[model samples]
Target chain A: MPLSAAAPRRPQAGNRAYLFITPFLVCFVLLFLLPLAYAGYLSLFKDQLVGGTVFVGLDNYLRAVQDARLLDGVLRVALFFLIQVPIMLLVALAVALAVDSGLLRLANMFRLGVFIPYAVPSVVAALMWGYLYGPDFGPLTQLGERLGFAAPRLLGDSWMLASLGNIVTWEFAGYNMIILFSALRTVPVERYEAAAVDGAGPWRIAWHIKIPALRPALLLCLIFSVIGSFQLFAEPNLIQRLAPTVIDSSYTPNLYAYSLAFTSQQVNYAAAVSFLLGFVILVVSYAVLLLTTRRPRR
Target chain B: MTTTIERPRSRRRTAAGSHVARRPRSERRSNLLTLGMGALLVYFLFPLFWLVIAATKNTGDLFSTFGLWLGEDFSLFSNIQATFTHNHGEYARWMANTLVYAVVSAVGAASLATFAGYGFARYTFRGRGPLLGLILGTIMVPTTALAIPTYLLFSKVDLVNTPWAIILPSLVSPFGLFLMWVYARDAVSDSVLEAARIDGAGELTIFFKVTLRSLVPGFVTVLLFTLVATWNNYFLPLIMLNDPSYYPITVGLSSWSAQAVGGNGSNAELLASVVTGSLLSIIPLIAAFLLLQRYWQSGLSAGAVKE
Candidate 1:
C-alpha cells in the first residue's frame, strides 16, 4: 500500500511534533551530547609513544587522581571557598537587609550602584582592577606612596590569591544581594510586623525571621559561588601575562586544560582532563543542590 | 504589642523626622549603620563613576586630573568620535556582532527551551524523568570544564572562527530549559489542555495556540535571562574566535586592554573605547529592563521562589 494511504489521515501528529522539536534536539546532541560522548571516549585512553595513542583504559583517570597540579588547583579553590563565600554572602545579606528595611533613603540609587558591577563583563572588571592593582602607575599604589606606607604588591605570590578573591567578591556581592533581597521580599511584611509586636528587636528579627527564611537563597548563592569559583580561568589567565612569576600556565585546572589543548596541542589528554574536571564539578554541584533543595522538616 | 505602633506615632510628632529619627540613642545607632552602608555603596560604585568621569577627559586630562575628580575639559563627544574612528570602527563592528549574537541566541534559545519545557510538562513520554535529570545533570558541569573539548569538537568541524561557535552554545542553555519546565508545569493547567483537546485541537495546536499564549510571561522571562547571559558571555568566544573582527564587545574590549598594557599604542584610546563601549553596552539592557521592569522584577522573584 502507498505510504500516504497507509499512514494515519491526520498529517502524522507525532512526526509533526517531533519535527517542531528537532532543531533543539539536533543542536543539543551536536553541541552537548557529542562533546560529552567524545570526552568520555577520550578519558579511557592514554598517549602511547609507539602505538600513537593506544587505548589504555582507566589510565587517564588514574593519572588525574595522582596529578599534583590538579590536586593543587583543587586545594586552591577549596581555600577560596573557605575565605570568599562566607564573606561575600555575609556582606550581600547585610546589604539586602538594609535595602529591604525600607528605612534607607536612596534605596534604588544604592541598589543600582552596587549591582552595576555585576553587569560589567568579568574580563573588563578584571582588567580595570588589574590596572588599579598595578604597583607603578595605579591609583592604589600611588595613594599608598603618598601616605608613606609601603603597599604590598597586590598581584604578588603572597597576596595574589586574596587579591583575586577581593575582585570576585566585589563583582558578585551585589548580584547575590539582589537574589537575597528578592528572597527576603517574599517573606511578607506581616511576618516582620508580627515579630515587632512580639517585642522582637531588629537583631532578633534578622536572626529568627530573616536569616531562617533566607536559608534556601543562601544555599543557592553558595552553590553557584562554588561552581563559579571552581571555574576560575579568565581572571587569572589574563593576569598571568602581567605577572608571569605569580601565575603559571596551570595556575588553575581550566587554564591547565586550555594550555594542554591549544598551546600544547594534546587534544586527547585535554579532553580527558576536561571530562574528569566536569565529573568532579557535576558531583559537587549536584550534592550541594540536593542538600540545599531538600525541604525542611516541619 | 502596642508599644511598637506607639513609638512610630510619637516619632511622627517631632519636627524634622529625618533629624529626630537620628537623635535618639537607638535611632542614632541605626543612622550610623546606614551611613556606613552608604559609604560602602559608594566604594562599590567608585569604578563605574571613574569610568564615567574618565570618559569625559582626553589623554592629557586623564592623567593630570585628580584620580577621583572631574577634569576642566569635557571631551566626551571627541572621545566618542575617536573611539569610533580608531581601528577602522572596530568597536562599532563589535557592537553589531554582539547585538546579533545576543538577540538571535536569546530569542532562539528561549523559544527552543519553551518547547522542550512544554514537551516535558504536557506529554507523557518514555524516560522523561531520567531525560530531564540528565539535562539537569549537564548544568552541574562547570562550563569552563567543557571549553577544551568543545573547542576541539568545533575545530574538527571547521566552525571555530564563525559566529555559530557562540550562537550554538548559547542556544543550549540548560538553566533556561529547567526554568521553562517549571514555568510550563505551573502556568499551564491540564484542564485547559483537555478542553482544547475535546474541541478537536491536536497537541501541536494546543501547545502553539493555547499553552504558548498563556506562557507569554514565562517566554519573556526566559528571553531576558538568556539575553543577559549571552551578552555577558566572554569565555566561550575567547576560546572559539581567533580573529579580532569576530570578537564580541566583551572579548574585543579585553583585547584592547591587553594591547594597551603591551604598549602597542596610546592606552587612553583603548580605555576611552572601553568606557564608551561599556556605557553603550549597558544601555540596551537598561532600556529592556526599564520597559519590562514590572514583568522582569516579578520574574526574578518567581525564579528564586521556585527554586
Candidate 2:
C-alpha cells in the first residue's frame, strides 16, 4: 500500500533521493559513526606515565574484564534493570489499562498528572528526589516524626539503590503509559464487542484481547527500559551528593566511565570500559528481541 | 424476534439512563477504580507539590520547616529574584542558551528527519535497506557511551566548551528519522505527488508545498522530542562545556545543586535558588507538552501503532 510500490519507478528519482538524505547522512557519520570509531581507536591505547600514550591493544579491555569496580557497576545495573523495569512497566500497564477501560472517573486528569513527571528534566527529578530523601529535613521524615515512627533513611547505603529506582520509575512510568495507552487506542472496538458476545466481561477481555494486542508496545518499552537502565547516570550522579558514602564514582557504568575520563585522566581506559558496556547493552537488547519474538503466537 | 429484541433494547436504554441504581456492583467497582487512580495521582503529583512548596520557603525555613507545608515566610518572589540575579544573572544566560540550543536543534533535526524520511519512504534507491537499517541500529547504542568519545573527538577539533559541540550531536536523532519515515509512508499519498508532478512542480517544490503540509503532525512530534532532548540534555553538555555561560538549564541547575550540597558556607544560599530555578525551567516544557498534546499523541500513535 506504500506509494513506492504503487507508483511507476523513474530513473532520476532514485538519484535525486540522495539529495534529500545527504544532510542527515553527513551528520550521522560525523556524530554517530565517527565518534564510535574514535572511541574504538581510543580504547586500544593506554596512557602511561613513563612512556606517555602507548598502544596496548586489548590490554585495556582485558583489564576491564577483571576490573572489580567496573564489573560491580555492571552487575548493579543488571540488578537495577531486573527490579526497576518490571515495576515501572507493570505500573504503566495498569494505568494505561485503567484509562483505556473508561471505567474510572476523570481518566484524562489521571493520565496527564502521571505524564507531568516525564516533562520534568532528569536533572531536576534527581534534585527534587534528593531533597525529598534528605534524612534531616525531608517532608516524609518529618511526617514520620509526627506519626511517632522512625522512617528508614532513604539515602542510606542499603536504601540508596531503591531510592534511585523510585526516582527513575516516577520519571518514566507516565511516558511508558502514554506509549501503551496510544497503542491501546488503536485496538478496534469490534474486538470488545466480539468478546462480549462470547460472554467475556471486562476483566476477561482485558486479559485475553487487550493484553495480547499490547505485546509489541510492551516489547518496545522493555528494550527502552533496558537501554535506559544500562545508561543510568544522571540520577545516581546527582544523588551522590546526598549519599556520598553509598554512591561512589563507580556506582553506575556510565558514571564510572565519566569519572574515569574526567577525574582520573584515564581517557583511554574509560573508552574501553564504555565500549564494553555498550557491547553488553547490545547483547542484552538483542537477547530481549530474540526471546520476545521467538515465542509462538496463537 | 423483533419484539424480543425491542424488549431488551428498551430495557437497556432505561438501565443506561439509571445505571447507578441498576448496576450497583459495577458502580462499586468503578468507585474502587477511581479511588485507586486517586492514590496513584497523589503518588505522581506529590513531588511536584513538594517542589512548589519548597520554592516558597527561605533558606532558613527550608531547613527548619516541614517540606510539604508552607513556611512562616513566603519568599517565592525573592527566591525567583535571587535565582535570576545569582552570579551576575548566569541563570538567565543559561535559560537563553537552552532556548537557542533547543530551538535550533529542534528545527534542524526535524527538518533533516523530514527530508530523509520523505526520501526513504518515496524512493527506491540503492542500499536503501542497509542505510535505513543502520540508522535504526544506532538507536540501541547507549548515548552515554558516545558522550566521552564525542567529547574526545570534539576536543581535538577545538569545538569543546562551545555551543556547536552540543548542537551538532543533538541534531542527528535516529529515532526522529525513523518516526518520520513511518509517518511519511502513511501520511503522504502517491496520487498527491503525482498530481503535483503533472502540474510541473519540481520535487523540492512539491515537498515544501505538499508533502510538508501533510507531515506537519509528524514534524511537530519530532520537533518537540528533539526540543525536549536538547533542552534536558546533561551528559553531553556536562562533558563538553566547562564554561557556565554555555550551560543549559539542566547543567546550570545541576552545578548550583552541587554547590549547595558540597560547597562552603557561602554557597548554602544556593539551595533555594536551585529549587526555584528547576521550577522555572520545567514550566515552559510542561506548557508546551500540554498545548501540543493533540499533535504529539496522534503523531506518536501514527508512527508507532502503524508500524
Candidate 3:
C-alpha cells in the first residue's frame, strides 16, 4: 500500500532534485530576495553631508508618513484606481460577454483588434496618445476646430490624469477580456442548455448563469487591476514631457521614487518610499482578496 | 416530465426570433450589436490608423492638414530615413539595444522559468511547498516597488547604465514560473519520467531528452511574456540608464519627444520623427502578436485560469 501510494508520484531523486531548481533559486535570491532585503535595510538610514549614511531607524518611515508629495501621489493613484479600474474592467467585461455570446460577427478579428493595443508598448501608446492629445496637430483637436469649437486640452492639468487612464484602459481592456472570455468558455454547455429549456432569455442566461460562473475570474482580474492601478508609472512618466506643467516629478509613487532617487539623489529616502508603497499595496490587495473570495459549500 | 420541460422551451425558441435559439447562428440580424461592435473596433484601431497616417506627413503638413486625412505630401520614406538617421543614428542604436536586451532576457527567463517549473511540478523535495509559495508571493511585489532597491543593489556591482541593469532583473519571471508550473503538472506525465529513469537515462539527460521536448510550449509562452515585458520596459531603464546610447526604444523615443518640446518649435521637425519612430518601434511587436496570437491567447488564458 505504501509503495502503491508513493507509486503515483514520479521517482523522488532526493537532494539531486535541487539541481533542477538551482538556476531559478539563484535568480530568486539575487533579484527578488536580496533586493527586498537591501531596500528594507536602506530604508532605515539617511545619507547626511558630514556624517555619511547613518542609521535613522524608522525616521525615514516617519518622514514618508508626513511627506505630502508622497501622500498626494498615493491619493492620486488611489483616485485613479477607484475611477479607472471599474471603467476599464467594465469595458473589458462587456467585450468578453459580447464576444462569448457569439452575437458579434468576426469576433476573432474584434478580439484581435482590441488586444493589439496591449502589444503596443505602454511607452509607445502614451506617445501616440500624447501626440493625439496635442492641441496643435492631433486629430481630435483638429476635429474640434473644424466643428467650430475650442479644442479640448486633453493633456492640460485638468484632464491629464484621466487622459492617462484612457491610455491604460485602451492598453489592457482586451487583455482582461481575453482572461474573462476564457473563463466563460469553461462554463458547462449543459447549464446553458438547461437554462434554454427553462425558456430563459439571453439576458437572463447571461445575468444568472455566465456571470455567476465568472465570479472567480472577475475577482482575479479585479485584484490584478487593483495591483496594476497602484503601480501606474510608465504612461504618466512618458506623458509628462508632453505636458510638463501638468505632470510634476511627484505625479505617481513610482515616478516620485525615480525623481527622488535619480534627480534628487536621495536613494535612501526613495527606498523608504518604495517600501511604503509596497506595504500599502500588500494590505489593500490582501483585503480585496479576502473579502471577494468565497468558500465552497461542502 | 420531458414533454413538460420541452414544450415551453420550444415555444420560447420559436417566439424569441431564433437569436436566443442558437447564439452562433447567423439567421437573425441584430443591428444594435453590430453597431456596438463596430464602435469598439474603431476605438481600438483608430489610434494605429492615425499613426500610419501621421507617419506619412511632414512637420508642416502634419499641423496644417486635417489630422485624419492624408496630407498634400507623402513623407513616409523621408520620415523613415529621418527616423533611422536622426541624432547621428541614435534611433537605430536604440532599436538594436532594445532587440538585444529583449531577446537575451527572453531566452534566459524562459529557460529558467521552465526549469524551475518542471522541478517544482515533478519533484518531491524538502521545503518544496514553502519554496513554491515564496516564489508565488513575489508576484505581489510589483516591479516598480522593487526598482529602487534593485538599483541600490545593482549599483553596488556597478551594473547601472549597462544592459545588465535591465536584462538581469528581466530574467526572473514569477508569473512565468507559475504558468509553467501549472503547464508542467498537466502536460508531463509521471509515467514517462519513470520510464526514462528505468531506461538508465541520467537525470540531466532525462531533462534534455524527455522533459524539454514537452516543455517547449510553456517555454515559448514564458519567452513571449518576458520578451514583451523587456521590450516595453520604460521606468527601469529611465532610472538605470544615463547615456542615450544605452536607452531602449521607449526611453529613447521619450527623450526625443521631450527635446522637441524643450526646443519649443525650432525643432518642430523632430515631432514627425518621434511619430515615425514610435510607429517603427511598435511594428515588430504588432507583427509578433498577430502571428503568434494563438499561442499568446492560449498561453494567457492557461496562466490566468490556472491561477
Candidate 4:
C-alpha cells in the first residue's frame, strides 16, 4: 500500500509466487466462497413434500418480498440502525474531540476506560447487561425502585429495542471514539493554532476544523455500524432467554434464519433468508461507500 | 496578565479568584472538559465494576444488595468453587476448549496471513488485482449471514460438531491479510529480497530468515486479535456444537445462565455460580487487554490504511 500507484514494479514474482498464497486461498474458498455459493444455490431450490428440492427459480425471493416476519425483522434492525448508530457516533465523536483538544486530564485513562468494553466479549457484555436488566433482582431495576419510582422494565415489549440500543452503544461507542481520535491525531497542529487565532472557541474549533478532519473515520464508523446493524444476532439472541415474552425466536433476520434451519428444519427457506439479508447489507454498504467516496474529501 | 484583568475584576475578588480571572476562557473550558471525560470514564467502567463485585455475593444478596455497594456476605471463593464444580466441572472443560481453539486458530491464521500478506505485497502476480478485490470485498459481508451457510457446508463434510468448524473459519480473516500486507510493504524492502536472491538463498529461506524477522509486530498483532475473536465467539459454536463437552466458555456460560433463571427457575443458587463463572471467563481477556493495550491501538491504526 505504501508503494506509489503510478509507478510500475519490476517483476520479481515467478509462477511459484502463488505457492505463498495457496494456503490462504484454499481456506478462503472453503470457508468464504464455497459457503456463499452454496447459500445461493440452496436459495434457488425449495423443499417440497412431493417434489423434494425442486427448482423454485425466483419463487423463494418472491415469498421473501411478502414475508412479514422477515420484513418486520428487517424493519426493526433498520430502526435500530437509524437511531442507535447516530447517537453512538455522536457520543464517540464528542469524546474523541474532547481528548484530542489536549484539554482532558488523564486523557489516556478516559480513552482506555471507554475502550475496555470493546475488549469484553459481546456475549459476556450482553450477559452482564442482561443480569442488570432483570426486573426482579436486577441492579438497575432495584436501584430504580429505591429512587422513588416503580421498577423499570427494560426488557418489556416497548423498551426492549431501546435497551438493545443502549447495550450496543455502550459496547462500541468507545471503539468508534478511538478510531475517530486516531484520525484526529493526524490533523496538523497548525490547523488548530490558525483556528484559535481566528478567535474561534473550543466548540467552534471542533465544529469547523476537527469534525471536518474526522470525515473519513466517521464514514468508516458509519459503514461498519450499518453492517453491524444487519449482523445484530449476538445481543438479541443471547438476551432472548432473559425475556422470552418480548424477544421472539425470529427477533432478527439472522436469528430467524438460525431458528428456521436448526429448529424448524427449513434449510432452504433459511438459506434464502440469509442470502436476502446479505444482499440488503451489501447494497447498503456499497451505496454508503459510493456516496462517501464520490465526493472529493476536503 | 494579572494586571490586565485587575481593572475589570470585581472589588470582592480574592487571590485565587484573581488567578481564575487571569485564565483565558478556553483554559477554563478545559476544566469542564476534564470533568466530562471523567463522566464518560464512569459510564464505560461502571458495568465492569458491577460485574466484578456482583460475582462476590451469594445468590440471595445479589437481589437484596444495592447496585454499587458490596454485599455484607463475601462468598467469591465459594462461588469460584461452585463455578468450577458446576454441572460436573463443565466450566473447566469449556475454558480448556476455548484456549485450544483460540491458540490454534491464532497461530494458524497469523502464519497464513503473514505468508499471503507477504506474497501480495512483494510479488507482482497475474489476477492479483481482481483476487485482492474479491477478498477485500468479503470484508463487507456480515459474518452472521455466512454462519448458517457455513454450518451447512461443514455438515456435509462431517466437521460440523468438531473443533475444526471453529478453527477453520477463524483462519480466514480478510482484515488480517490486509493489515499484514500494509505492514510488509514498508517493513520488508525490495532490496533485502534481491540481495538474498543474489546470495543464492531460496524464496522460502529468504522469507523465513529475512522477511519474517521484520514482520514480528504484524504477526503478533494478528495473533492477538484472532485470539480474542475466537475466544469470545458465541454464535458459531452455539449452532455448530451440540455436544456439551465441546462447548467453549461463551456458549457454556450462556447455557449455565439460561438454566439458572430458565423460566422454570430450577436452580436459584445457580445464579451465584453463573456470576462467578462469568467473572472467571473474562479475567484472561481483560488481563490480555491491559497487558497488550498498545498493540490494540497500533493494530487498529494500522487498519486505518484503506484501499
* Candidates sorted on lDDT, descending: 2, 3, 4, 1
Write the residue-wise lDDT of candidate 3 on A180-256 in tens digits. Answer: 98667656566776777787766677799988888878887887787788889989887777777899999998889
| TM-score for each predicted model, relative to the true structure | 0.86, 0.94, 0.92, 0.91
For model 3, report the TM-score of its A chain: 0.92
Question: Each prediction's Cα lDDT score?
Answer: 0.74, 0.88, 0.83, 0.82
Model 3 chain B: weakest 10-residue lDDT segment is B1-10
Residues A1-298 of candidate 4 have per-residue lDDT tens digits of 2334412445755565688889999999989999989888988999988978899897888898799999999999999999999999998998888776655677778887887788777888898899888888788877788788887589999999999999999989988898887666555556665765666666777899878777777887998898899879889987898898899987898888888999999988888999899999999898887887696768
List model 2 lDDT by residue over A19-66, tens digit each: 899999999999999988998998999988898999999999999999
Report the first chain's TM-score for all candidates.
0.87, 0.95, 0.92, 0.91
Residue B268 lDDT (model 3): 76
Ten contiguous residues minimizing lDDT sum, candidate 4 chain B: B1-10
lDDT by residue for model 1 (B91-114), tens: 899989989999999999999988
Q: In candidate 3, what are the lDDT values of residues B127-231, reduced to their tens digit? A: 877888888877788888988889899998899989999999999998889888877776677888889989999988999988787677667778887898899
Chain B alone vs. reference chain B, TM-score for every model: 0.85, 0.91, 0.89, 0.88
**Reference-based lDDT, residue B288, model 3:** 81
Best by DockQ: 2
RMSD of 2: 4.9
